[model samples]
Target: MEGFLIRAVVVGIGLWLASQIVPGVEFRSTESLIAAALLLGIVNAFVRPVLIILTLPIALVTLGFFLLVINGLMIELVAWFLKGFVVAGFWPAFFAAIVVGLTSWVMSGWIGGPPKGRIDVVTMRQTGPGRWE
Candidate 1:
């Protein structure tokens, strides 16, 4: 879907930004960078929900801070599978996760524009004969 592709690109940009900002995160090539984004999307889509469910109690107990741990764990999983992508350790992955989230949020908001919640006064009808119209 269009939305998914946009999100992948945002995540990819976030990955690149994280690599630049965090010394511990590294990608050997552009191919691996793209692969990381796609893999990260797949992991977030399929694996994250199950992990969240299994670790719900711990996540709740940690007042949702453990979600950051889960995010870093996802990065570790990515590193384990991808040959060129490397997350140095838990802290680096954690920082990368933060970067990814912030980048995605800002990029998506900017690209997608404002939310569809505002009233459009120009589109209102004035065809009625009543005084209220």
Candidate 2:
């Protein structure tokens, strides 16, 4: 779907930004960057929710900071799955996650999509006697 492709592109940009900003994160080529972005989305969609639910107690106890670790773990998992992507260690992955997250957040706002729960309204005024436009 169009929406998925848009998301993937946004995520790809984020990943590219991360690779530039985070020292230990690297992508061998554009294709690998694209693959990593798509796979990251898929991992977040399917694996992250389960991890969150299973670790709810720890997440609550840690005041939700554990989610950052989970994010790093997801990046590491993606690196493990893709030969062309490399994350040197947990610290780099953690910092890379932060960069990617911020990039995605900022880019999504600028990209001009219909955001969730947004509403549009139209109003009309009478132009002449018994006429409205």
**Top TM-score: which candidate number?**
2
Q: How do the predictions measure up, each by TM-score? A: 0.82, 0.83
For 1-133, candidate 2 gives per-residue lDDT tens digits of 7877888888889889989988999999999999999999899989999999999999999999999899999999999999999999999999988888888888788987645885879899999999999
Best by lDDT: 2
The number of clashing residue pairs in each candidate reads 0, 0
Residue-level lDDT tens digits of model 1 in 1-133:
6667778889999999999999899999999999999999999999999999999999999999999889989988998899999889889999999999899889977898335687765645567675333
Cα lDDT, model 2, residue 40: 93
- TM-score: model 2 vs. ground truth: 0.83
RMSD of each: 4.4, 5.3
lDDT of each candidate versus the true structure? 0.90, 0.91
In candidate 1, the residue pairs with backbone N, CA or C atoms under 3 Å apart (3 or more residues apart, or in different chains) clash, namely none
Distance from true position, residue 67, model 2, in Å? 0.8
